[model samples]
Target: MTGTIKIDNAPLNKFHLKITAFTFGSNFSDGYALGIIGMALTLIGPQMELGTVWQGLIGSSALIGLFVGSLLLGWLGDRIGRQKVYLLDFLLIAVASFLQFFVDGPLALFILRLLIGFGIGADYAIGPTLLSEFVPKKYRGSLLASLTVMWTVGYVVAYFVGILLEKAGPDSWRWMLASGAIPAVIVLLLRIGTPESPRWLISKGRIEEARQIVKRFIGPNVDISDLIADGQSEQHSTSFMMLFKKKHRTRTAFGCLFYFCQVLPYFAIYTFLPLIFKAMGVKDDILGNILLNIFLLIGAILSLWFINKLSRRTFTIGSFLTLTVSLLLLGIWPHGPFILVMLFFAVFTLVMSGFSNIAQVYPAELFPTEIRGSGVGLTNGVSRIGSAIGTFLLPISLASLGLGPSMIGLAVVLLIGAVISIAWAPETKDLSLDEASQTPESSSQDVVSSSPRKKMSSH
Candidate 1:
């Protein structure tokens, strides 16, 4: 048999599990921030006397900040170190949360949300990179995908908190919004003093540090000479432009397209689900959030099981197609009865849950250690623009064009995403990150050289 793949084929350990949870806490905070904001807006809108336009701005302010954070932090992480940027972002998140409790006006709250989004954006870039770098290839997909589970759990927790505090008088919204700080603080604590990624260290030419990381956490007796060789071959400096280089161009396009396709509709619908529930005749906001999250969580769990079984390309395309169908049904009858609306939303959430989980996993798989942060960060940042635009305009669309047209538009976006996924997304299942991130030309050469027939002749 061919010798085992050294770099990515290492065995896993407890430290890996611990760090994975710590990293996952970032996604939990992200989910909480987005989830709590929706309910808080319903309450805060009237208290602050905000209009539709201002509500939309408040809704999208963090996303706008996220756009900047993802790009800037991703670049920074690669230049400095993942550990440094990752920890600092959570601090920003904590400070932003505390400041939000003091908001007396729309502008103050919006600016605070924008600052929170900045930190979240950086987490988006740095967190996944840290996770992917530490985990062995065998467990990487599921472990990385578990962030979706954390996100769903966080969302549910926030909803629970919102419901519990709903009867706490007019200031309940403050409690809901400010509560996000707790999780961020916990994440900061959990990740404190954790080592930087070994893969990243190798990419930076710190072979000794990388070796210690591999030996201590990755697996004992796992050789990494090939990994170091590959890291040495890659471009060392960090920049978004690195993604556009010939080797990474195709993968970059795939990652961005994958993110934008789902997030555009995902944010537009899920971020404003509370409002959408009202439009659909769901009288109890608390009940609606709990019920909707149940199916959403179920879908996320299903995706965890299915991710390893299904091809990334096929699952993504099918999810978009399914989402398109659900949106089409909603567009056909936007004001349908409660049962009909619930059915459509259930389908939409299920599809969205699967897609979102896979989207994060793919980005970590597509880029090499050197540019992984920048690659995922840039695409994530770019897709945040899509999310922001979609969310900012959804309210306007609902008011002017009616919910029918908005659903139709989301359907169109899904269809486009499906087409792109079918055309470009590479198969990443069963491959280690290094193996998966290799350029097509390099992979082909490795395939030819590792042919069984060549090995047989040598023997």
Candidate 2:
């Protein structure tokens, strides 16, 4: 069970931060590419002479790709390894982005956009899982929480790019879309120097290689003597079905349900923000979209500050509550003053940011290393189903119900999310990935079984 130990003076926190930063950078690039498509769709649609239905179809093409990719590639990451799949995904994304430059008609653009979505969907599942596996227990939550920071950076970059591209004229949108290829190139290059997950290696019985990778981070001198688990001698391989085994089924279901609820309302609100603003009498679509991105940036920044300060469960619940109230207000008074509309948008951004920050970290902590990737991927894949439904149905709902009723419907969904989160999600603020994976049922049994059995002697 024991392995070679290393010791060093550098803080473990510093190493974790570096690893997180690298992963974050890669994700930032992927997210920027994805965000731009959503932001620029309005401008690109009409200039290309697309009708309402066609516009919706073009915009949703990427999401359709994402929905499929998340399930297939996410499962692959779990079955093979995170690093290998991640590197391959970056390459695919680069190719997709490069091809986007050549899109001339609706069918061509739709296909290219769908490929880009596939890359994004794969990255979404693998990136966070890689980052979470590499960090130490003490800083895991905050370190993993930082993925949202990268996501925001991408969104901000897209926001400015959208504004600039709008003025860049008709041909300029092509360049703006293709510009996303640059980051993919960078990530592909940078990831070549990165190591595979040490824990994954160890679980797969490649102890020496795992030790070498761990040594790179913890320094050559630090003692991992106490960190290695006795169970390393035992096999730890897992399959997708293992997630639903007797001991793990409830945990897997909980994780999947939480992710589903998290995305249901969040995507519903986000995908329709511009439309909602227009309904509220904001005639300028570009301006409305830009403002939405700004509010999203503000929310992302505030989330970084509060995510580590509060309990994961508390912050998540509070965020849902905040979103619920904002949606309620917006629903009740769709034609309110500009200031009130802006207020709701701002609050919506803030709460959604908080929810997103916490939500990404939660799944990474929910399963053992053996099944962590599968568990996260499965949950995320299921969540994408909800997102697909939201993306497809929200505009239709808005069309029929008006902005007010649409907001109210989303508010009710968020309320349901808040209730489910409070009931089933466990607190995992400071626990290590492995410790958090240990089921509550097992822990309770340990407590009960260890109690003294001296009743006969007393009688």
Candidate 3:
């Protein structure tokens, strides 16, 4: 016995990897649904003759739904089991997508999106948290980062598909909105018999059940005796207020506020990328979306590579600075030629690619097994408010203040995110979920029982 007895020693097997792939469907669907909105809005706004407030609501409404979904599903996952809450969300997404296809007006569209948002909200809260719980700690950071890539991939695919279908006429947007049902349906169908998070079972005091799950995941060869012992360390249940306790309070603040600052500007800028381009005289909406999604994919690829390598604070703070500078350039030179705007815009997308990747990992990593879903859900809920504010107000901001001022305002929000990252971003590169969430006293008391690294590799 030489190293810490963290949960990493549990086998990283095919079953775990399969779970990872299945979880991708949710993130992919989320990206597709949300990304499609920008294009959908561009078409619908004129047909409906929408006002600024209505435009804002339509854009932000799904995000509002996300907050509601996160709160409800997140708690439900913690109370019930992650798999149960996980499987049902995709059904909700499919239903909402179909409803969105038939909806007549902004009000109808808004309600439908809210329902879709709720489904996405559950995925946002549960996907990463559950993935982190299931995977080996050795690959947790990289594997979890892949969820963001899957999201970007879905978004990029939606944009490309939208471009092809542009010839379908104004009705094309409805088709685009409805398209998400395909993957949601696919993910749901694929999730048949997805296993419960053994960690959740352990948290619920079902020690024997957790043991059986560990054996299946790690293979029958290895003994999970100590693993079960380590897991039982968690108290039987947790309340929302417990997230506010001293041990976890700081992480909660960091989780909620950091995401708030980042998404505040991120959503505002990206949600309105088309409008921003249109105002700058870039006429081809399809080309504009293609470039944005391409750059976004490139950024996500870069993020996928760098997430494990970069220091958390350095990465987060640097990304915000990059976003701030790129956005500020757009604001300062409001009328810069297309190439200049495109260059800055591409640079901003590239920077956020990596940053946003880590942003997804942080909340999932911040808390312990007992409340990971609820905690991440709450933080994401806060992010939705930020997104809602940005989305709901961006149209008004662009109209009232023009491109330069709106971009500058967004840059200011990114700056605030940089500051928060500097102040609070925690380094989580190779740490176990349990290790990352350990209180100071707990860390001191729960000394390593053996060479956890050696033990983890034994099987």
Candidate 4:
């Protein structure tokens, strides 16, 4: 078997499980940090006497921070190493989270939120790239997909926590914001001493170190010769521009577009569900938000179960199609009865949650070890741009165009995602890492060379 195959086909073990747990913690922290702000804003808005523009700034500051953090840290991870950058990001998050309690004004709070987002962005790029390099291909989809589930869980739990803590008088938002520090510090401690990626090492031509890590953490018998040998022809570097080269450009574009489309609607809706529900004239907007987030959490969990069962292309295309249809129904009938409006929201959330399964994992899978960190980071940064735009605009859209038009606009975004997926999504379901990461032209060549007739004739 090839070195990539050897790594991909290895049995899931204790080490893999531990890494998954740590990564899940990282994602959970990220979800909480992002989600808590929506609820906190209710109090922050009034107490700080902030207007729409300031609210948008406060809400999207982290995402803006995410854009910066993802690009800088992702490239840094590639240049320095995943392990070195891994723990520090969480340290930054924990510190920022704790500082949220002391923010006396909107500016201080926005800066703090931006810092927290920056840390989460770094983890976004590093966590999946590291996990994908370690896990077996058979379980890779589900394991990596679980990261989103944890994020949704974190998000849902944050809302529930916000509801419970809302009784903490006028100062509750401070505690809600600071609570994210708990998970961040815990995950940071657990991530300590995690080994470096062997594939990354092999790509760097540190053969002995790669072999030892594979043998120690993975297995003694796992062969890495194929991995090292294959690297001979690759132009190895961590440069951001490398992702745009002919070999990787299509994947780079596809990664950014699909991720951008997915999150634009998701973050926009979830980050301001309370505002949206109020716009719909829900009797109890808070309870409605709770129920919707529950659906979101459920879909994320189901995605973990279904990811390995379905092809990546199928999941990407099907979920976006469903999302588009559901949102279109809601957009078309914004004046409908409460039941119908919520039904559409439920359907949209479920489909989007399912789509989240592929979002993080797909980007990491698109590039080889040589630039995996940068590739995931770049796509992540672009996706943040979508999310930031959505979050920034949702309040204004709700205020100006009302709910109907905004929902239709989201449908357009999902429709675009569906079109992109149908056009570009590849079948990387059971392929080894090296095979899956090949550029389209190179991958097609491999299929032809490895065809049954060619193999039979050669024999």
Candidate 5:
């Protein structure tokens, strides 16, 4: 009976699927909320008489709100609990989404979308952190990678929904924005009784509670003994400052930088796909966007397999380099033949989808249970800053720099991401949670199988 349970190699079970379903829904809601606005804006801009500045504000506001939500609530999730915050944030998203249907002005709509973004941000911090802790290492990479696919599906679905809703009438923009409530509400119900992470429980020294939950939900023989031993050092501060401390600073930098680089161009390009298409001289912007997004969705689906097949470092670095090349082609030949333009856009979206998939898995794996939420949140928050900036400035850039130069700028961003990946991306494939979270210097020790070291608590 002693030390018999080892979650690192445990087989997939029903509980794992349940957790994945709940987390998947959250990412789906996020993608829908963020993507719907791009199309809605085409209608809202003229109907509401919004200029580029207001449109940019309205477009980027949710991303700005994400920055606030992740930095604050992500830290709070660590102190409180994941399930509590998970349900709370969904309530916020659902309420904000429904409120959008009643907005009379651009300012009101902006505020509502920002609130939705805030809720989505909180979920971003919690969902992967929660799911990653519960999933066995055997399926962890693919399971977590699947979230990005859900997100892409949600984003593509938003476009399809937007196309249909646009035919509903002048007020259709209101309904389009509010449609985000549907997914949020559904996920909220799905998460109603989800359990807290046993790792979080163990980190907080509720060892008996952790053991009982793991036994009941996971299995009686699944061992959390090492987790219990690790809990003894639970005095590590969950403060944001701790992320910048010597032990975690490298990971913190890589997580934030890589995420920021990937999303800056992603939000910038995809959020205005129609506009980019028109600028590129595409005759039917709407149809072109749909096909391009389909390619994006395909890339996300493909990454689920690639994540396990290639080392994380190799996949990430290669994805970025490929993405950079795709964008550079479009940049250098802004008015390329119709087929070439479509091909470049398709390549960029496809590569970007796989590159962005890392965002779901890498940040959560960077920190221990005590601050996993915070670590994920901090990276998410920083990345949103990049997203917000790119979203807000894209229109302005297009107006001044023209589409060709703007494409070049985005290509440069991807090139920077490739360099950063080469410099710092860690290979986390096949590693257990304990091994993945540790710095390279200390990861040689298989702490999960080793005898507990004797130590006195600071407390």
Candidate 6:
């Protein structure tokens, strides 16, 4: 008789959960601030006496700063440690968020938003890396994806807050902008208590310290000594050029292309959604904004569910296809009832939610522990440049082409993203960070060598 054996997976510990919560909190703050800018720009344009050109510039200012910060800070995250970089990012975002209240004109607001974008751009790359490195392989996807959930919650909170404060008149936009400071404060306090990533420590030759952190969260029952030892042996002296080596070149290329296309459609749609609704005759701006938040929340929840269940490649492709189809449908039939508009918007949000959540996890998984932060940041920085372009161009498109053509253009961009995702991306689902970091070319070689070759009979 043959016996079946089952291996039990370890659950996350209290420390792991606590640290993840803090990370989630920080992400929520960053996401809330970003989401607010999208909606606020839509609502504040008329109220602030700003033209569409000025509005578009102000909306994209953060993205420009994000482009710069992600590159600079992402490199810094790898050179320093994930935890240390994350700890300081909050203060930067908080100070920037508060300073927005002092801005009196478009130029001033644009500069302040740029600073806010820089801080958020830094957090975007660092937050996911911190969460993924700290958790075990089994729960990493779900835990990291939960950042999307927190992000939705933050958006929802901002939506209601904006509505309530709208009654405070145009001046209340200052308060809404200032509210971003709260997350920075929370992150600052929580960061003081959070520890650095153990995986990062192991990569840096601080094995003993890494071991203690593992013991605290993973418990002393399992034998992690061997795993740590293996990591130490395989640790190569890392540099930025190492990311472009033959073995890693494909992954680096894939990461950059995937992120670039992903952001193009995402920011294009989001930055213009409220304006689209207004153009569609949604008279009540507050109500339209509230509906947009609802869709965002729904998308966040659905994304959290599918990110772990489905393959990363599958999710990215599927979401892009769905978004593309929805945008096409909206373009084909420009005039629709309120229900149809809501339905389409919901679909758009749902797909985007999945894209946002999965995108973060995939890039982090593609690089080694030592350079994971840089990998994520570089892609994010590149993606933000795309976002900056999209943000800058959307208003121009809307002015010249009208809503249908504008949305059709966005759908075309999403279709391109879907194709790139399918053709170039690898499936990282259920793989450990170490395993996921293996280049596709090397992994294919291993697969071929592992297979037994049959001897050919002599003819």
* Backbone clash tally (model 2): 6
Q: Which candidate order results from sorting by lDDT in descending order? A: 4, 5, 1, 3, 6, 2
* Clashes by residue pair, model 6: none
For residues 162-240, write the lDDT of model 2, one tens digit per residue: 6677677777778778888888888778777667777677677677787787777666654544335633656665777
lDDT of 1 by residue, 1-459 (tens): 155447566677788798888888767887887778877888998898888788788888888888899999998998888999988898999989988888899999999999998998998888889888877777888988888788888877877887788789999998889888888888888888888888888888899998887777766577888878877775665666879887778778878877887898887786788777666667775665677799889999999888888877778888889999999898888788777887898889887886789867989888887889998898889888988888898888887877888889999999999887777777666776876676554433332233233324433
Candidate 6 residue runs with Cα over 4 Å from true position: 1-9, 42-48, 284-286, 442-459
lDDT digits (tens) for residues 1-459 of candidate 6: 123211113467786687778777655775676567776775578777888788778878888888777777877888788887788877887898898888777888898888878887787778888877767777888778877678778767876777677678767888888888987787788778567787778777887887676666666654455456657677565576777777777678778777887777667666666677766676675676677777777777777778867867678888888889998888877668877876776788767866777766788888887788888888888888888888888888878888788888888888888877666677666766666676645643442222121111111
Q: List the candidates' TM-scores in order.
A: 0.93, 0.88, 0.92, 0.94, 0.95, 0.89
Residue lDDT tens for model 5, 1-459: 565757666678899998898888767876787789998999999999998899889989888988888888889999998889988898999999999999999989989888988988888888899999999877888888888889898899999999899999999989999889898888888888898899999888788888888888788789888888777955767777888777777788889999999999999888887778778888888778778888988899888888889877788889989988989989999898888888888888888887778889899877878889999999999999999999999998998899999999998998898888777776566767876787643322322122121111111
Native-referenced Cα lDDT, model 1: 0.82
- Flag regions of model 3 displaced more than 4 Å: 1-7, 231-236, 441-459
Cα miss at 362, model 1 (Å)? Answer: 0.4
The RMSD (Cα, Å) of candidate 5 is: 4.5
Better of 5 and 6 by TM-score: 5
lDDT of 6 at 322: 87
Residue 153, candidate 3: C-alpha displacement in angstroms? 1.3
Evaluate all candidate structures by whole-model CA lDDT and list the values in order. 0.82, 0.71, 0.79, 0.86, 0.85, 0.74
Query: Whole-model lDDT for model 6 versus the true structure?
Result: 0.74
Candidate 1: give its CA RMSD in angstroms: 3.6
Better of 2 and 6 by TM-score: 6
For candidate 5, the lDDT comes to 0.85
